[model samples]
Target: TKTFVEVQQRLDDVNSKLHETVSGAREIKSFVTELDELEKFDQVNDNYMKANIKVHKLMSLLDPAIVLISNLAIAAVLLVSSYLASIYTGEDKVQLVGNIAAYISYLQQIILSLMLLSMIAMFVSRGEVSARRINLVLRTVINITNPENAIKPGIIGEIEFKNVSFSYNNVNENDDKLTLNNLNFKIPKNSIVGIIGSTGSGKTSLVQLIPRLYDVTSGEVLIDGVNVKEIDLEYLRKNISYVTQEAIIFSGTIDSNIRQGKVDATKEEIEKAAKLAVADEFIEKFEAGYKSPVNQGGANLSGGQKQRLALARALVRKPKILILDDSVSAVDAKSEALIKDNLRTLKDMTVLIIAQKITSIKDADYIIVLNNTGGLDGFGTHEELLETSEVYKEIYNSQLGGYHE
Candidate 1:
């Protein structure tokens, strides 16, 4: 009990501090999960402490009260036998001594039996209480709302966000405040739009809502003219392929990683996708070629190689809407340019590229520039935005001296 309580307290303290430091909602959730687990351990310790106290009290009564009374009874008999022996000096004295000795031996046996029974009772009580505690923890309820009256989204690639607002609890309104507020946007079918934002401008949050990672607090996100909340989650997600900024490549060969998207993809299709993503050159460099084993998260691979491999994985899915959430940020300028060029060749595909650098999205059909605050400061093509948007001019001047062709 002591050890468990100490460990629980330590974990809670450390995770609480971590919760304060981490800004991302995902990281905050992980810290909260850790805190919850520690609280459960603390509850178990509480139950164990209560049981230990009860057992201690019972032991005290068995040792002091019952043993003391038995010892007093034995002492009184010894005194009486000694007095009788002094009064009568014969075989009667011997018989009296034998009876006293037998009585003392019987008393010892009774005392030992009582101690044994008391110990058994204490252990049984502890067991029963521990069982109840474990059962309570197992039966504890978690708060997760269920979906109601949801419909299938079909294969439509339409996406829209209307008057969306979101806020987390216990954060400062003046400093680290609301991420997105009253935001409105639409992604038209077969249109390639790019979302550019400074750090913490809710870029990830905005795209995350398309897949309903989080429901908007007070507005609606619609897919194919149907509210996302009304659509079946599985059906909606199957049509969208999202490659995140963090390229996650599991420990496997190049072929295995690409085949992850479509398990039934043929060797020819896999090779074709790799070529399109510019991953073929690097794969061939390895001695084992396509069969070379990749380490966890592709740790051994270069940054550009990982990005290209992730692109291959996403391409193999042949999704209706491709959402690249800063997926090409790690690759070189030339490699990113190749991927961008390849994106243009995808027929009937709706692509959304979220990037940091302006060069990454210069050729995009439309670029939406987000300010440090949660608001859209500009939205247009590279040429139009440069001519009209102040933020775009500043970005252009800050990076490439001017928006030169």
Candidate 2:
């Protein structure tokens, strides 16, 4: 059983390595680590092979050894009975021989049952180990759920964070562990808000709260004067569409990918959304156009193209609140500008864009500048932030060479 467990672990490690190399093939090749990756995989595979051989050798010897001992015991019984029979009288010797035959038959049955029990015990031990692992996954709890008396809102696309703070771990006792600290901001209906921050500034954490992905440790998040916790979880998420930095493109046609946002969307609506994201230009170049097949993870398309397609998917939803979480970072300035310009047509949608580049969000109606401590340093137009926020000004100067009028 111990050898069996070792083999199982080694087999899992080998499988993990295989998946990592296959999924990260491009990265491995670009870094010129083909030989290194091959060596790592070979090592893992060899470990699995050795472990498997050890388990098989032990198991194979067990049954044969049991049979050898049982045969030897029967031979000893026969030899002793024969010696006893020689010392007995005629009728007594015959009776003694008959008794020895019956004893031998009973001993054979006992040995056979014991051998069967041993095999069953070995398999049961392996099964028990696997069952414990499966039970752990099944017993895991999901922390987020709809609150009591949840309201299905008739709300406008407004958002507010009132004295909000959050952390992935328990921050109720120690506030110092907060990822976002006392973030206070309100976005009116149909407004555009830009959020800019350095790495680890909790930019993603802030936007995630609006969708109730993680409940705040302290304070509240409100939409249109009503607390988000009171709102129906499903309704709140349905009205919001979030596009992340990494584009997830499934294996299917272009139409199917964008239609994931709205399953019942018309073909024309898909095309319109693609045009808005500037994805239509390259898409039309394909011989199949909307019907063009996409490889898994958008392997067939360039990084910029994948970003544009993902943007189109979000736009097609026409959700009340749209979030672009650095979704256009891979695109060139010309294409990114066009997508931003096209977004202006959605006058009734509240949009939040998280960006690393000032050129991407400087023109936003309200730009949120976050410092290293997850505190808002500025919340105003680009011109206003240039005077109020040193962080914003420094970023603007570095990216654009200087702040423009």
Candidate 3:
């Protein structure tokens, strides 16, 4: 059983690598623009090939071992029968012959049965492992679940973080290290709030809490004065639209992907969302237009095109709160400006933009500057932050080619 488990693990690893090699072959080919990259690809392929060979060798050895054991059993049976026949004589020998014939048949049946049992044992071992894996997943308990008396919020656009702190590891909550430290801020209804910080400063982590993706370890995340944890999970997420940093496109038509945001969205609504996201410009260029096929992960489209399509999907939702987590990084300056301009037209909806570019959030109604320690450095308009926050001033100067009077 232990040997079977080890072999099964190796087989799974090899299969995973084989799948990656096949699926990412085109990407690897495109990325092999230099000698070093080509060499790396070759090295990875070689390692996978070697591992595959080892597994095959182990499996090949099993057949010979089984055959050899069967041969030895037959030889032993023949030797014993020959000795018994040699010791018998006349009528007793005749009777012994008949008995030996029946015994030989029984011996053959036993050997055949043993071989079948061996095959069954191998399969049963593998099946047991697979069953255990499935059972583990099925038995897993979800940490985040709605309470018994969950409440649905009346209005969800307004968001507040009250002395909230979060740690990825809940086992040791008292540890000084945390992903987000005592964050206290309020975003009013119908406001455009921009969050900017250096990498690993918890920009994405902060916005994720708004949608109740993760519950705060300490303090509370409130939506319209109600603790987010107390609200129904489905109700909270339904009113919020979150566009992640990575533009994840599915294998379907452009229209189908956009319609995922709102299943019952009309044709006009889809087109309007596309236009607002600036996706219609390129989408119209295709002969199929809205019906154009999009490959899995949007591999056929450019980075900017995929980002715009993702933005269109979010826009179609028309949620009360929209969170864009570095969603415009792939877009050019002109297109980014246009998208921001269109976002301003969305009334009665709170928009939160997490961006690396200062220009992306400079004109936002409120700007939040987070330091590297997961704490707020400053919170105000771009102009106010520039005067009050040295961090904001440094970011502004770096991006805008130095400060001006």
| lDDT to native, each model | 0.77, 0.90, 0.85
Ranking by TM-score: 2, 3, 1
Candidate closer to the true structure by lDDT (higher is better), 1 or 2: 2
Put down candidate 3 lDDT per residue, 1-405, tens digits, no spaces: 555555556666666766776677777678864466556556666665665566467656766676677677667767887897899878887887677678667766776776677667768876887788788899999888998999986864888999988887763445678888888998899999999998998999999888888878898998889998898899888889899999989999999999989999999999999999999999999999999999998988999999999999999988999999999899988999899999999887899999999888989999999888888889999879988988888888888977664
TM-score of each: 0.68, 0.89, 0.87
lDDT per residue for candidate 1 within 118-184, as digits (tens), equals 7777666556656666888999874223367767655557677787765544244343466776677
Pick the lDDT winner: 2
Give residue 348's error in model 2 in angstroms. Answer: 2.2
Q: How many backbone clashes does candidate 1 have?
A: 0
> What is the alpha-carbon lDDT for the whole of candidate 2?
0.90
Record all residue pairs in model 2 with backbone atoms less than 3 Å apart, i.e. clashing. none
Error of 1 at 77 (Å): 13
User: Could you tell me the lDDT of residue 225 within candidate 2?
Assistant: 88
Count of clashing residue pairs in every prediction:
0, 0, 0
Candidates sorted on lDDT, descending: 2, 3, 1
Q: Candidate 3: lDDT of 373? A: 81
Q: Which whole-number lDDT from 0 to 100 does residue 44 have in model 2?
A: 99
